[model samples]
Target chain A: MRRWLALILVFTFALVAPGTNPRAGEGQAAPEFTLRDIDNKPVSLKDMTGKVTLISFWATWCAPCQVEMPHLQKLYDTYKDKGFMLLMISADDARSVSRVKPLIKSKGYSFPVLLDTDTKVVSQYNPNKTLPYSELIGPDLKVLWQHQGYTAGDEVETERRVKAALDALAAATPPAVAPTATP
Target chain B: MPPTPRAALVTAAQALLLGLGVFSSGLAAAGEGEERPEVSVSGQDDLEFRYWRDDRTLPDFPEEDHLFDYWELVNRVNVKLDRGPLQLGVQLDAVGMLGAYYYLNDVRVDEFDLHADGVTFPLPLAYANLDKAWLGYQGDSAQLLVGDGYIAFGRGLALSLVKNTNIDIDSSLRGAHAKVTLGAWDLTAVSGVTNAQQVWQDNPNKQQIRPDHWHMVSGLRIDRYGLGPLNLGAHSVVYSFADRADLDAQPWEGYGRGVDAAITGASVEAFGVAGLDLFAEGDLFLYPGGEVLGVEDNQPGYAVYGSAAAYPGRVALLVEGKHYKDVERVNAVVSRDLYEVAVGPTLEYERVITEDSGAAVNSNDISGVRLRADVAAKPGVLTPSLTLGLFRDRELGGLHFNRAPETIVHPIAGVDWIADSVHVLANAGFRVDKRDDLPGGVSLGADRMAHVDLSLGFPIGSAHGEIGGDLRYFMWGDNLNQQTDFTLLTANAAVHLGHGVSIVGYTDWTDDPLIDSVGNINENLYAAGELQLQPADGMTFKLFYGAYRAGIRCAGGQCRMLPGFDGARLSATINF
Candidate 1:
């Protein structure tokens, strides 16, 4: 009887526990918070309304991050015109600001880079205890998906998610009404 | 409060059963999947049952008598579900260990029972990796997984657990993971916490323990866009430790001041030429108190590594080189993980002459070069493997390839022959340097020593029961004004006698020389045997009786505090 109770307790945790990252198809609003970018400018989550958002938390010295940056830039470039915004929050030290800015320039990346010098945004939003994690937020302010780690196969999936989010937003926006409607 | 023995026994039993159940589940899964051509499991259990007579070595210390017992079971199940699509599956293992105190060696330094010292029953303790599970899916086109897992990037100078899991700490994370690949581009991401074993144990004890040690990681890799010979990968992390107080209180040891964002770095690797591939990576860590630390300290650590493998028909030759700033073990807060640089070069040769009979030969040659300043020198542990290799520095005694201080010269040569179910192996090396690190000053030419070993192994009968034995010897030349000759002979045999029972035994004899810092020899002696039996497939009972002049065990080049036992030991591993 005691063993049965213990097993039941474990099953309950699996079902109700808030996992390391958000699960797909979970109908819940994404946590919102504000953080300052590298330029010491406020990047508010609420302000990025009516557009799909990709928030990536990263550090400068990570090996996998070095491999992932170019593709992220590509994703930003391809869908920037379609109301898609990619916010990269770097957890690097403030001293690294000088180093990171140069790295960005050398790579010729144009995406908006934010600095979480204090790591406040990570704690409030996802509280990710692991690294190389990404989140896709729908324009409706719900967490569409969340995942961790980087591998050779993740690039294709990220692209598909980006395009799908854009399509969903486009469909949600009503077409322009005819001018004769006023008459 | 009184120490009740019954409660401790019950917890131990629970842990044992849970571990067995998990092991059986994995075995059952492996038998079901045909797609998995190779399925295997490795399991180990360590249990110490003893009655304490005293906690000290001599008569001066107080004496206490009590029955103390604990056990740990670790089982890993791996399956290559499909090679064509490259699907890989692994289970982190079910951890079953009980009681407030397991063993002197097994106890976590910080763990403690909150009850009164004399009381034992209903011992308040913490557990890890229980009722935890994870799954991973991998393929050429795409991959997906939802379960607890682990991730590491680069050489682990920044984040590297995808390989080495030597450290007895949080190596696996509890979370959901996924990755997808398209042509030359690949992306991956994971979300999890430090240890899945702890799971929700911190909930009810939230005030005392915060369960919010959570994180999310994502990155991508692109290679040879067909535009140019280029490769790139990047990683990012969003993490938060629910309880930062513990980290905040620790002293800044060059690594960092804060817990969150302690390990954060970036790298850019490239490939060129047919045989040459190169890489360079760096890291940055942000912490509280307005302090920033690099990989080891505030200094950015970088390295360049390359390898060349040339295959002339079926015979192949390969050489790999790694040169990086060394991460100082002590005073990391003040120094970069790597300061002075060292280089390692290894050449390996392998070939197969007869494919049908499975006859093959393999060999490797190794060399290392070090550049260091006087300030980086520190006393470190000694490892026997370094003596076996030919190339080693005499001026530095930190030990091992990664921890050596000052200049080092070391090389290794080895050969292996395999035919059907039979195999033979032998390796020899010589190492020397200018430092007075060894017990003796340069007595032999240029402070160098020699190590050699040989072994032969084969299987018998239709069941492929394995039996093997070998001999190894290490001779230290009186190079650094010191002299000692050490020889170790080990013989091992394993036979499946009948039914579910198997008998295995091994004996080791060693001739060691005791010497002082000046290389003055003090004593020379011999030490020798181990016998174990598995009555059934589930439990392995072992009787280890050995007379050792000295026994030493080390991890990460760090030596553990082990008492020299000249008598006997009884041990067992039981799995359901």
Candidate 2:
């Protein structure tokens, strides 16, 4: 019995040791990926570098995700002109991809919806692959915040984080130079 | 003053209205750019009335007949408040029954007796209680929560506290929980008291109500991520039972102090590895000296589970295996109800060996393997799949497999099709169980089982609605080589009549050969029609009349038998 216990301890230590910083942790650079939107148009994360980006990984079968979508849309509409963007990435696989378009259309949402058919992009952002996962990336491509799961009224905190990031970005940008007469 | 169900319902409604008023007023008072606490309210109420014809006597109470007419109303309310980093939530449930149901009335004699200290209500019915109330704080890197809540770890293999209303089970722990993330490590800890069971006893002289004893539970888990694509985790849980000699005198006593137990496990999972994902976990259970059927001894057990899946191109394949030995020890300390207690991991496969069959895992002497493959025949249009499973179980105390081992093999094939407005799904499966080296004269259980299910749904373009139908058949070959079969057919249709009004109708028919006795066929039919109105956003009301039949309802590997009836149902829901 003692031997078994020792063996298990060794195994756990071996797995836990030797791990470097995670790629998706706060202050780490967000990975870049290109995926197709609901209309089959390519969307790349690198293109949105000058603005604060909020990427949410969700699925149609997740109840909490469904509840959070409307709030996300509201946030997007409220801050779209203030250098903020929200992208809802659907992790529906090939088997259930057919249900995504109809659901989005039925809900009358104007936010851009992307399909992660193979779940390749979501895995880069969320190693655990938890549903309704949200990550906020600053204008500098560094992850500002990350959250797993959702509950009613969680939108408040999420909105606060997004606004704070946007405010910081605005404060960092230099003012525009005065226009000069034509030479 | 004491309040009845009717008065309670009125009070609840008034309180909700008052809350809404306050929320609105608060929102109005907040000036532009001012921070205000966010409040949200959501709830649903279901009222159903049933009438019985050709009433039969209940098996338990042979002297009395089943209720000829009855009505029940179930209401659930949830309120959430959030401001900055602090959060508060409350959820309440109330159930009221009125009818000729004597048994149900007797059960309500002491409904208000067992409540958490410092919590009180005007109406304390058998079905009314404060389901959940919690206060929590969310930080950038940590979270602290207290009061009633749900918790789970690593696919719930070792510990899971959840609530399933469909099965009338709520295992939410009343406790304190904390989660923190430090660099590459994530830590979680929980300490709580399990919810007590509500048992009702009916006697001629006096009605008796006893609450199931509660136990202490604590657990800790640590997880490390960023090992490329691999993440590892370790978890341990301890259940402590209080010494209660009084419980020994009861006819149905729960786990006592003598049967304290602990579970420890470790898991490793890897994802995004060349389109392959893998996970494996091993759990060890330790039980101090305990008496099993009057025999006392300490028996330790262990279990191992692993699964691998790969989605390469259009084809998806998965393989899983599990082996358990003498690991089925009672662990009610972490569960709200005794029936919902489970200490073993559940392995889910297709039909024959379903996940809902936790009994298969509780045997403590079983091993199983399952393999499945799915191919996208036409991309998103059609998909077909095939599955195979094998399970083996050895005798109670035998180390060798030759001692009356039971083996089962199951194979299944299925297909799913989806188009612009049409969807269809079907599956067929067969199971064969073989036994070897039977004891002197013991009989075999089920030898063979087969089943088929088909469902089709489509939109009625002209009517602006949808219609669907389902057909299912199942056959069981019992020990005596006798065959029993069940057939079910159902059809439903709905239509929108504009102005936020809709009409829906459904009918179900069942034919079972084993409902009563051998060779006695029982056929039942149920029909229902409903009208739904959604006059505005966040509000809906539905009224329906139906004739229903009793049947088994299952969800999330849990099953419950619900009594059927013929009656009307009214429901309303609002979210804001």
Name the candidate that leads on lDDT.
2
In model 2, what is the error at residue A75, expressed in angstroms? 17
True contacts kept of each: 0.00, 0.00
Clashes of 1: 86
Task: Name the TM-score of candidate 1.
Answer: 0.44
Worst lDDT run of 10 residues, candidate 1 chain B, spans: B354-363
The local distance difference test score of model 1 is 0.39
Query: What would the per-residue lDDT of candidate 1 be over residues B93-207, giving only the tens digit for each residue?
Result: 2222233243345544312333223222231332222223433333334555444454444333333322112112223445556655566555666555444222221111111
Chain A TM-score for each candidate, in the given order?
0.81, 0.86
Give residue A183's error in model 1 in angstroms: 82
> Which residue pairs overlap in candidate 2's backbone?
none
Each model's lDDT: 0.39, 0.57
TM-score of every candidate relative to the true structure: 0.44, 0.64
Docking class of 1: incorrect
Model 2, CA-based lDDT:
0.57
Docking class for candidate 2 = incorrect
